[model samples]
Target: MAGGVAAGLVAGALWGLVFVAPRMVTGFSSVDLTAGRFLSYGAVSVLMLLWAARGPRRVPTGSQALAAIGMSVLGFTGYYLLLVLAIRDAGTEVPTLIIGTIPIWVMLLGKPEHLLWRSLVPGLLLTAAGLGLMMASPHAGTTAAGSPNYWRGIVLVLLALACWTAFAILNAAWMKKHRDVNATEWANWLGVATGLGALVLWLVAGSPARELAAQPQLPLFATLAVATGFGSAWLATILWNVASRRLSASLCGQLIVSETLFALVYSFAWDGQWPTPAQWAACVLFTLGILASIRAHR
Candidate 1:
């Protein structure tokens, strides 16, 4: 359980990088960024699989391969595409706040049969309080609520939230049911599937290769893609899988608050400014929520 908690926290830290990643390469289309990142992940996964083939790694069966593809679409390619589009349309604040409710939804739906509802109240309340603080913070930015694009962005974010929430529950259930399927192997399979899906998305929607090549920040874009692909997508998936297999889905869901916390830290660092008192307090509340959830689980 300790190992699982640590893994989940680390995964959150890595996953947080994605919140700022699209901003870093603002010139690129969402499809390009998504494709580049997952392509790198797929490349790495393929290389690792080849290396492991010399040893005794288990290859996924046909049914498992199909499952990987479906999950990759839900949790990786489709979800991220929608997220990038949401941020592009509506700015970051509203979308982020809406997405922040994911832990609450997951906890409500994924609660263990043995765990009492009262045990979850403290964690849920603390998390909600943290989100409230974040929403009230000036740094969260304001959106034009009346704009068509804003509503569209809100819709996109909600869909993104739904995709990931479903993924969280189903992925946990899948990992728990298939105890023989190790975390690393599952991550690799998903990586390959995501890469394929991202490739198709890119081919269909990304800018032409010549136009992308002409961009001044191409190298920066590539670096961010590779860094996030390896750390955030591939490695984080392994850590998350480990956490899912070891912890209840509700506990794992609570731990996702760490991602929002780390994302704020990264966003502030990138802007070369400190967080406001409200933001700092929110971070504290988020930490308390995770601890409360951990206690409840134990």
Candidate 2:
């Protein structure tokens, strides 16, 4: 249990880096950022697979590889694109708030057969109240520093939330069905798939060429990409798997709140602004709601 708690905290901290990385390269659009970040992720994943395969690890079949790639599209490529766009158009607060609801969403969608309506209702109400507080808070749209489209950002983040919920549930199902594949290996494969997805996005969607033509900060961009790719995406994936292995489903669900906590901390630090009074209250409410939901699920 202590190991699970430690892994959850570390994973949350590492995952928080994603929220701040988009800020560092605001000059690039979300598409460009996704491309660069996932390319790095793909490269590292390849290296990982090569090293692991040397130790008698089984390589994935073509069909299994394709399944992983498709999941990576939903979980990594598309999700990052939407997340960065949300952070760009709104602030971290609203987007993180929406994302913070993912655990509840996963439980609602993934385990509907086992839900207890009595506890579930109260849990949902608390979650709704918590989200309402965040929406009504004065700090809701102020944290982005320069973003201008809060409504658009909110919608994008909700989409990201759905994408992630689907990814989490489906990924778990896949792993359960294929016990031969270890978590680290599966993560690396997803990274490879994300790279492929990013390449397609780069070819068809982004303005990376123009963004670069306009005196992009190459060094800073590279550093941010590596941090997000390796630290947030790769390291967080591994640590999360560790926690998931050790913790019960309900406790693991509650622990996801740490991601929102760390993300909020990093967002405030980046902007050199303290959370407003309402923001602080909202945070408390969100924590309570998450706890309630997890308890209900249990």
Candidate 3:
């Protein structure tokens, strides 16, 4: 359980990078970024598989392959595409706060049979309090509330939230049921599927290669895509799968708050400003919520 908690936290840290990645490459569309990142992830998976060709490898069955593709869409390609669009349209803060509620939903829905509802209250309340502070902070709500784009972004973010929340619960259940399917293998399979889906998405919606090449920040875009693909998408999925296999989904969900906290840290650093006192307090509360959740789970 301790190892699972650690893995979950580490996954959150890596996942946080995605929130800032879109901002880093303003030249690229959301589709381009999504496609590039997953394609890179796919490329890495292929290399890894080739390197392991000399050793024993477990090829997934048809059902498992189908499951991987569906999960890849819900958790990787579709979720991220909508997230980037939300950030582009509504700015980072609002979308992040909405997504931050994922933990609450997961916790409520994925509660363990042995754990009492009361046992979860402390963690849930602390997390809610932290989100409240973040929402009330002056740095939040950057997009004008009245704007059509803002509403559209809100709708997109909500859909993204639904995708990921379903993924968290279903993925955890799938991992628990299929204990023979190791985390690394599952991650690789999912990566391959995501890559395929991302390719289709890119071919359909991504900016032209010529246009992308003409941009001054092409190198920056490439760097961000590869970095996030390897670190955030591939490696983080492995870590998250580890956590999901070992911990209850409710516990794993609570740990997702780490992503939002790390994202805020990265965002503030990017802007060359420190978080306000309210933000700091919110961070503290978020940490406390994780601790409380861990204790309850134990």
Which one is best on lDDT?
3
- After the best TM-score superposition of candidate 2, give how far the Cα of residue 168 lies from its true spot, in angstroms: 1.3
Model 1 TM-score on a 0 to 1 scale = 0.96
Lowest-sum lDDT 10-residue window in model 1: 139-148
lDDT of 1 at 169: 96
Q: Which candidate leads the pack in TM-score?
A: 3
Off by over 4 Å in 1: 143-148
lDDT of 2 by residue, 1-298 (tens): 6776677668878877787788866567788888988988888888998898789877779989889888887888999899998988887777887887876675565554555557666655665676677778777666663655777888899999888877767775676677677778878988888888888998898775766667458778878888888888877777776666655444455566668778888988888989778778777876776567556644
RMSD of each: 1.5, 3.0, 1.1
How far off is residue 33 in model 1, in Å? Answer: 1.0
Give the worst 10-residue stretch by lDDT in candidate 2. 245-254
- The C-alpha stretches of model 3 lying farther than 4 A from their native spots are 143-148
Clashing pairs in 2: none
The local distance difference test score of each candidate is 0.90, 0.76, 0.92
Alpha-carbon runs more than 4 Å astray in model 2: 112-129, 143-148, 208-216, 245-251, 288-298
Model 2 RMSD, rounded to 1 decimal: 3.0
**TM-score per candidate, chains pooled:** 0.96, 0.85, 0.98
Clashes of each: 0, 0, 0
lDDT of 1 by residue, 1-298 (tens): 9999999999999988887788887689989988999988888888888988999868889999999998999999999889888877877666767777888999999999999999999999999999999888877755445566888888999999999999999999999999999899999999999998888888999989999999999999999999999999999999999999999999999988888888778877876888889989989999999999999999
Ranking by lDDT: 3, 1, 2
